[model samples]
Target: MPVTTELILARHGEAHCNVAGIVGGEATCTGLTDQGHAQVRRLAVRLDQEHTTAPMSALYTSPRRRTVDTAAHLADQLNLETRVEPALRGLDHGEADGRPWTAIKRRFGGRPQQYPHRPIAAGAETWNAFISRCRAVLRRILDKHEGERVLIAAHGETIEASFALFLPLPLDDTELAGQITGHSCLTRWQRHRNTFGHDVWMLAGHNDTNHLRSPMEVIT
Candidate 1:
């Protein structure tokens, strides 16, 4: 027997800071830009069509403004309530919470590996901490919502962390640097009964962005 669940992970729309190349960590409260809003609207419309009657049972969102807004719109479309999960928040950047990427690259280009663990300027959290929290949160969500389909609205870092967990990779700065993207991904997990009386969770789909590139127009 196979116990399966579908997890839809969506990156929040482009924030004003994103367009400006700002490093928006957990502390940053930047909302979505106009284009970002349009993208979310398009996503909602598409979701509505796919799930006109059979929709996700619940919706989860990070505490950030952009995620909250995106979740709100999605909740309206699905007729579901939105729940906030602080653990789903973006990586905390301590002192460099809102600095531009260019500035960080300029200041620490030679030592990129050390940047994630460094204090970031004042008292920001390290990349290691961010990965740990995100992994824990995702695990909790999976356990709590077993066998149900869920939609999560979160930041780029949050999505990356979730992917890394299912894929089992070391969360290094170089790895994180290459994971950020605009499209959404679908990850499905299935629980199977083994001959030895053990249950295993297997990956069904990983990093799928088919919906974004379909013939339908995805504003993002």
Candidate 2:
């Protein structure tokens, strides 16, 4: 009997760059803002409650300040250690790091998602390249923890890439098709072996932000 593998993906909370409308690459990312921390804390509480039903075997985070900070809250809440995965990081903004989106659009001609092969700027990762990297890392993680529940704290783009990998969504139309993931939102997928002995993945959940709803959820 093949057991199911549960993979839960969590988007990082809002950062200063998010509010500032600037690219938040590793070079420029400081960490989560105060409201960001509060958001992650709410998520942490929810994950803690869910842990009783489905205990997480492992926790991973993208190698960015915002993601790491988000994972830190979950780690502390669940008493789990986190493994930083560089491949799980968001698209490389390269020269656009810390730069305003308007400036980047003027310099790079458009957003990185507009072209699959063309990078947003010199040294940046192309949209296609990012999807490939995310798929590879997701495969490695799934294989490493075949039957266990694993959690990942990463960026919204990383979550979008996951959808591209599992759902086989068109790379160009993923975000353009109005598939924007929310901050501190949770998405889940399950891998199971079918009767034909083939592995199939199911989208268990997407953009679940029940944790954010307190007395009243503040729209960011």
Candidate 3:
């Protein structure tokens, strides 16, 4: 029998790097700001209101501080068991870490890409590596939690990578420029086995945060 899985990927609350307009590599600027905390709270309420019938199965988050902080609010609201999964870590900014996005843009004349896989930045991980890990993480999550509603609190790049994993790889640079997952936004993907028993994945939602129409500053 084939299984169905509902996966929700929520970007972590705004971190210091978000406010400072810097490139936050994996685990850098992991803590949330004051408004960031508020964003999580609002997200929690939204989730509670949403899952009145279609309840969640489990909530997972990256080991990073910001994601952990974001999950904490959700955990409290729903009293759900929250697990820390390292595979959900953010992409590496490499030599660009902690540098302002404006500065990197000026230096690279816009987002530099090594095309097929490599990032133009000297020390950064390849785009190929990032998306590959994203695909692998999805497989791992499915293996353990298939046919369930699962939520993952992670990073913007992780969310983008997840969305991109649905697309064919070795992508053109234009396709590589994916959408931004704003602070505390929710993106969802679903998988179900076909009549032939092959699992097919589909995007149910992306970057949804209308529940947070507040005037607070959000990280893109």
Candidate 4:
């Protein structure tokens, strides 16, 4: 029988750069703020409630401190081991690390054409590369746990990049750029056996954050 999997995508809580208007990338490192901790606490509670019956089978996270910390909390609730995976790390901003958004805008005279496609100053990973890395990591996770309930704590950029990979929409680069926010979602994928004995993947959910009651639920 083909196996179906559920992925709970949780964006890491706020970091200092997130509140300081700085563009955070793999190169620029920051820890979670007090509010960030609180946000994750709320997230932990929400996940506990949602999975009270279903139960998560495993917990996974980026090696980044923010994501690791968030996954630790979820792991506590689920009694699962937290696995740190480097492939889940945020995009490499290269030269843009620690640069304020205002400075970036000033350099470009405005917001660049679109994210990923738009170069940040001079050095940064292109959108295609960002998407490819995210795809690779997500695929590895899916293959590792084909039919289990898995939880991933990652960055907003990582989540958005994965969204682009799973959903076939007419989202431009700019729109794709704006999709990531500090939030969490529940997404599932099921493998269906066809008449020819082949398994096909199906879309279950995308960016569902009902746990976030409102904008207030998002802690900066």
Estimate candidate 1's alpha-carbon lDDT, on a 0 to 1 scale.
0.71
lDDT of 3 by residue, 1-220 (tens): 3438888888888888788888776646658998889888888888877888888889988887889889998888877988988778766668887788888767766664435355647787666677778779877886788689888888876777776677644555543456768899999888868888798888778889876895444322
Weakest lDDT window of 10 consecutive positions for candidate 3? 111-120
Off by over 4 Å in 2: 1-3, 170-178, 193-198, 215-220
Instruction: Order the candidate numbers by TM-score, best to worst.
Output: 2, 3, 1, 4
In model 1, the number of clashes is: 1
Candidate 4 lDDT over 118-163, as tens digits, reads: 6666676665666678887887888898777788897776766666
Q: Give candidate 4's TM-score.
A: 0.78
lDDT (Cα, 0-100) at 215 in candidate 4 = 31
Q: Candidate 1, TM-score vs. the true structure?
A: 0.80
TM-score per candidate = 0.80, 0.90, 0.82, 0.78
lDDT (tens digit, per residue) of candidate 1 on 94-185: 66777887787577553233555554555766667777789999989988988777888877777667766776668565534445357334
RMSD of 4: 4.4
Q: Which structure is stronger by TM-score: 2 or 4?
A: 2
Candidate 2 lDDT, 54-147, residue by residue in tens: 7899999999999999999999988899999999999998888889988887776677776677888878888888989998899899899988
Q: Rank candidates, lDDT, best first.
A: 2, 3, 1, 4
Q: Which pairs of residues clash in candidate 3, taking residues 3 or more apart in a chain or in different chains?
A: none
